[model samples]
Target chain A: MERILEQIPRFFSGPNMTLLLEAAGLTLAMTLTGCLIGFGLAFVLVYLRQTPGMWALPLRWICITYVEVFRRIPFIVVIYLVLFFIQAVTPDASLFTIAVIAICLYAVAYTADIIRGGIESVPITQVEAAQSMNLSRLQTNIRIILPQAWPVIVPPAIAFAVSFIKDTALVSQVGVFELTFRGKELNNQGYSGLLVFGTIALCYFLLSFPLSMLGQYLEKRLATPRGERRSRKIRHS
Target chain B: MQHLEVSDVRAKYGTLEVLKGISFSIKKGEIASLVGPSGSGKSTVLRALMGLTPITGGTVMIGNERMNYSSAKEVRAARDRMAIVFQQYNLFQNMTVMQNLTLAPLKIKKWGKTDVITEAHRLLGLVGLSDRANAFPDQLSGGQQQRVALARALALKPQILLLDEVTSALDPELVNEVLDAVRKLANEGMTMIIVSHEMAFVREVADKVIFMDEGHIIEVGKPADIFDNSQTNRARDFFSKILRH
Candidate 1:
């Protein structure tokens, strides 16, 4: 306990802070790329859902298979799969590039699932209303439907981003110089272990706390009153 | 020429059949009201005509062209000639009332902004929502949303309008204002097919009143015959139960 306490001053005074920033940057890059990839796939899959039982059955199975396999295999395994199998084909790929690619592939699977739920969450009548206006299927998707689904989709997306920031620390094992990697190296170089990890944690909190708060703020702001949006906001309390 | 004709139509959703062998004809400039209890296939008839629900067997001929389900392009061409208003008012909540009203004409017609905005304001004025033109759907009452819904349907300049109980979802107090707005549109000789339970509006405004049961339209007649003096037992009972109060 004394050792842990003594490390605090050493942590703030050392070079560990810069490493955490690098980790946070890699995480954001992974999450955004993953989100964009997943969102694009989800857009395509939603149209496949409009087909009849036989045509949709196989397509749905493929999507569910992709999501379930990647989600359950563990992120560590996903990185290794990209490293060993993909590296065999594309030798000399940098660790940073590989980490970003693996995290994006993993994140895309989950984000696609999230977007699928968001698309389904929109009421059927809303889509029909777009059709009633003579908008085509694609037009209806971009113009009428996506606009309504966006507010509902935002809160969860931000929540995912915050957690994803922490998850990027795992990429350090693949030899990327992220925040966690830097903290560990600093501690190994004779900095106090407790102080190093503690400072690392503070940096993480600094990175994620505002994002977490922003998610909550957005959840409150985007929430529409079912009975009386015009008269009063729906009270969360 | 008859403006619209429905001959022996069968429409289905999933495995359940709705609008089973329903047939009707509407003259130009007529307001036809379909009245039925819930789940009685009244809404399905309008959906069938709009080609939202696929027809298993039948023909919907408007003017000389058949509602051809033979190809996607054919169905799309038929859809271009009509507009729809719903009970939920299904406004684009993200857009202001003016944006909602103008989107159809601007997007579907490729009309210039100045032309569409001026026409959109004219339609909003017709529905008495000129003042709330900039408000979102969330900023308006149920009545106001339905009024904007009317203005939106009008902006497309469609020859036929399908209204699926446009007032049923509103608060009771708000229902009258929307009905009055619809009544004015009906008076202007718009070819309209209304699915509604507002018997008073039907009796006074509808050229024809149709009573549907299960999946078929059981009876249809002049407003006096269908409402005050219904000829069929299904029609008579529906009128008695819905209008009892």
Candidate 2:
């Protein structure tokens, strides 16, 4: 306890603080870049997985297998596997790029199920009504299905991303220089382990706290019916 | 000339056949009501016409054009000429009544925005829902929603309107409001195929009443002939039991 207290000043000095700040920025960058790309690709995966008729059966199987396989594996394993695979294919790939790719791969698997559930939560009757009106499948999804599905999808999706701020620590195993990696380096350089890790923990909380709040706010806002929200807006105006 | 003709239409849910070679035809501006026990394929017939169900072995001819469900473009072409209202009042939950009525016209049909909105307002007035234009579907009663659904279908300017037990999900009191909307459409000479249990309304408005049983058309005649003088025991027994109440 005394050692932790004594080293606190050094731990939070100008140079150490700058290092921590850069690591934090790297962590946030990796998570946001990976998750945003992953979320977009998850939609494509789910759309292909739901392709109608016998012709797309193999495509459907491949999507399903990818989601199931990646979801069941550990995050660290995914990063290592991605590191080796990318190195074999393109030997000069940066560790940071490899980390982002691994995070993206893992995120697509988990969030694909989230997206599929959100889509399926919409009543099939809605699709039928759109179909009868000569609305194409793409039109139905964009106009009718996805708008209704957003209320179900956004909260959990945001929650997943917020939690992923911590999950990104796994990427440091491949030497990506994120928060955990910086903490370890500082500790090895004669800083107290307790002081080093405690600050790192605080940094992660600072990053994720606002995101969690945003998720909660969205959950409450979206759960209200559109008419009620409109009425509220009118009343406020 | 026949406005819509479905001949020898067959449909199946897996190996269990639900519609077995059913045939029916409606002239321009004619109103036909299909009545039968549940699962007798009355609803399936309307679904098959819209290509909602796979018609395994039949052709549908709309005016001079034969509908080919095998080709997606042709199926879409067939769909473009018709609109259907479901029993559950499946309005887009996220949209307001006006948006529901105007979406297909403005988007799919690519009609002018002002013109589609004008037609939407007119149709809403026809269904007595002009005041509920900004209301979401869940805010309205089932009857109002179904009426909005009818107006939404009309906004498409479809040549044929299909009503699949449109009032079945409504309360007893709500049933009349939805039926009144259909009656208004009928008065305007809208061509329609209504699968309904409302025998009294069927008898009053239908130009032809087709009785179905076990996926087959047991009889087809004027409303009075089918209701008061059914040709098949299945039709008579079914009608007597439901109509007695």
Candidate 3:
């Protein structure tokens, strides 16, 4: 244990440091881009699934099938499947592009389900109230329903984001040179495996800690009954 | 032209018919109460009129305009001139009392900012919730929340206000505050259709009372007629049972 602790400083020193920093930057880039794309697609999917009428039925079928297909399978299997499918279609596609696409496809399914749950958690009476007030469907959703739903949505969404950030490490298998890939390369060059793995783990913790804390703060803030939330924020912030 | 007329309205939930051809009309500046035992379709009538329930057969005339239930857009256009306060006091839980009252007026009506704010404040004062404007629905008591719901409905300046058992969910002590607000609105000549179980309060405030049973209107008359001098056995039976407790 002490030896592991001692190697931490050495992990940040030497030629290894630059490799670590570069990998960290790539991981951040992939996570940010993938999350944005995935979240947008998931919103479309949930919206299609929630809409009424025959026109939306086929769209909803496609969305439901896509979500179930991706969600039921292993992420690594999904990554390999997408990689092969993309390469078969366009052999010249960049490795980075393939990696981002794979992560986003996997992330979209889970995020869609989480958001749908949030939407359903809002009471039916809310929509009825909006209807009676003569607010359009778009106005009702944006103003009444979404605001009520976010309290249920934000915690799960952040959890998925942190998980997806870690999942970006899986892209290393496809030659993306993200964090895990860098750690493995350093290990191959005769560096202690313990130090390399430990450093990678530390980087992940550093990246995810603040985000997790922010989610907790949000959940707590929302849990406070509405009127008091503003005053409490003022008191603390 | 009548203020509102529901003619031969028929509604159903799957195979079970809830309103099997009920007809009623109210004049402008009239406060009508629908009093009946549970499952008598009093609430269904309110829901049908508000476009919440599908009226499979019937015509609803608001002033002289026929309510267009042909499409959702048309239904919304028809509903734009009316509002309903639900039994559950469905105030948007995320909004403060002030926002609940002002949201539709500001968003749907496109009212000016100063006008909307002033109107919300006025209605809040009218409901005796002037100081609780910043309180969220959950933060306030049941009575306060229902009052906020009433003020929110009034903010739209709806031509017809539908109240669906507004006092049913409140504590006995809390019931009076909500009923009092409704009474004040009645005095001011708001055209309202209230489905209430509060027999005495209904008698006191309603200009006309309609007694319903088994999805049919058994009697429609002045409050004293139904409550005191009923002409139908069904109305007399309902009044005796409900007013006994």
Candidate 4:
């Protein structure tokens, strides 16, 4: 305890603080870039998976197998596999790119289920109503189905992304200079392990807490239908 | 002239056949009511016409054109000329009553915005829901929602309107309000096929009543002949039991 207290000042020195701050930024960048991209790709994957007819049966099976395989694999194993595979394919690829790719691959698997559940939660009758109106399938999804599905989709998707901020610590295993990696480096440089890791933990909390608050805000905002929300605003005024 | 002709239309849900070679025809501006026991394929007939259920065999002719369900373009062309109202009053839950009425007209049909909005207000007035234009579907009673659904269907200006037990999900007291709206549409010469259990309304407004049993049309005639004087034993027994209440 005394050693931790003594090293705290040195651990938070200007150069050390800059390094930690950069690492925290990298961690945030990795999660946001990976998750945002993954979230988009998950929608495409789910849309393709729901393609109607016998010809699309193989496509559906492929999507299902991808989600099942990645979700069952350990996150560290995914990181190492991505790292080795990317290195073999392009030996000059940056570790940052590899880390982002791994995070994106994992996020797509988890969030595809989230997206599919959100879409399926909408009543089938709504789709029939749209279809009977001569709306194309793509038009039905964009104009009718997705608008109604956002409330169901957004909360869990945001929760997944926020939780992913912590899970990104796995990327440090592949030598990416994120928060956990910076903490290890600081600890190795004679700073107390408790002090370095403790600060690192605070940085992660700082990153995720505001994100969770944003998530709650979006959930509440989306949960109410637009007309009701407008009337609610009128009543409040 | 025959405005719509469905000849030996067949459909199946998996291996079980729901519609087995059903045939019907209606003239322009006529109202045809499909009356039957539950699970008798009355709704399935309307659904098959709307392409909501794939037609396993047979053909539908709208005017002189044969509606080929196997072709996406022709199916869409058939859908463009018709609209269907569901029993559950499946309004788009995220949108307001006015938005629900105008979405297809303004988006799918690409009508002018002001014209679509005007037609929407007119149809809302027709359904007596003009005052609730801004209300979301969940805020309204089932009757009001069904009326809005009727108005939404009308907003499309469909030549043929299909009502699949539109009031089945409503309370008894609320049934007449929806029926009254349909009555008004009938008076306006809008061609319609209504799948209904409301015998009195069917007798009053329907130009023809077709009785169905176990996926087959047991009888088709004027409302008086079918209700008061059914031919088939199945139709007679079904009507006596239902009409006695």
Best by DockQ: 2
lDDT of candidate 3 over B65-95, digit per residue (tens): 8884768876887788788999999999878
Candidate 2 lDDT by residue in tens digits, B140-233: 9989999999999889998999999998899999999998989988999999999998889999899999999899999999999989998789
lDDT for each residue of candidate 1 in A62-149, tens digit (9 for 90 to 100) = 7677778888887888888888876898898888778767777776676666666777778888788787667888888788777778
Cα lDDT over the full model 2: 0.91
Pick the TM-score winner. 2
* Per-candidate total of colliding backbone pairs: 3, 0, 0, 0
- Give chain B TM-scores in order: 0.96, 0.98, 0.97, 0.98
Q: Which residue window of length 10 is worst by lDDT in model 4 chain A?
A: A222-231
Which residue pairs of candidate 1 clash?
A19-A179, A20-A179, A23-A179
Best by lDDT: 4
DockQ ranking, best first: 2, 3, 4, 1
Quote the B-chain TM-score, candidate 2.
0.98
In candidate 3, residue B73 scores what lDDT?
78
Report the candidate with higher lDDT, 1 versus 4: 4
Better of 2 and 3 by DockQ: 2
Report the CA-based lDDT of candidate 4 relative to the real structure: 0.92
User: Which residue runs does candidate 4 get wrong by more than 4 Å?
Assistant: A88-92, A213-230
lDDT of 3: 0.86
Give the clashing residue pairs of candidate 2, or none. Answer: none
DockQ of structure 3? 0.71
lDDT string, candidate 2, A1-237, tens digits? 888888888777998889989999999999999998999999999999998989999999999999999988999999899999999999999998898898899889989999999999999989988988888888899899999898898899889989999999988878999999999999899988888898899999999998899999999999887778878877899
Per-model CA lDDT versus the true structure: 0.80, 0.91, 0.86, 0.92
lDDT value, residue B227 of candidate 2: 92
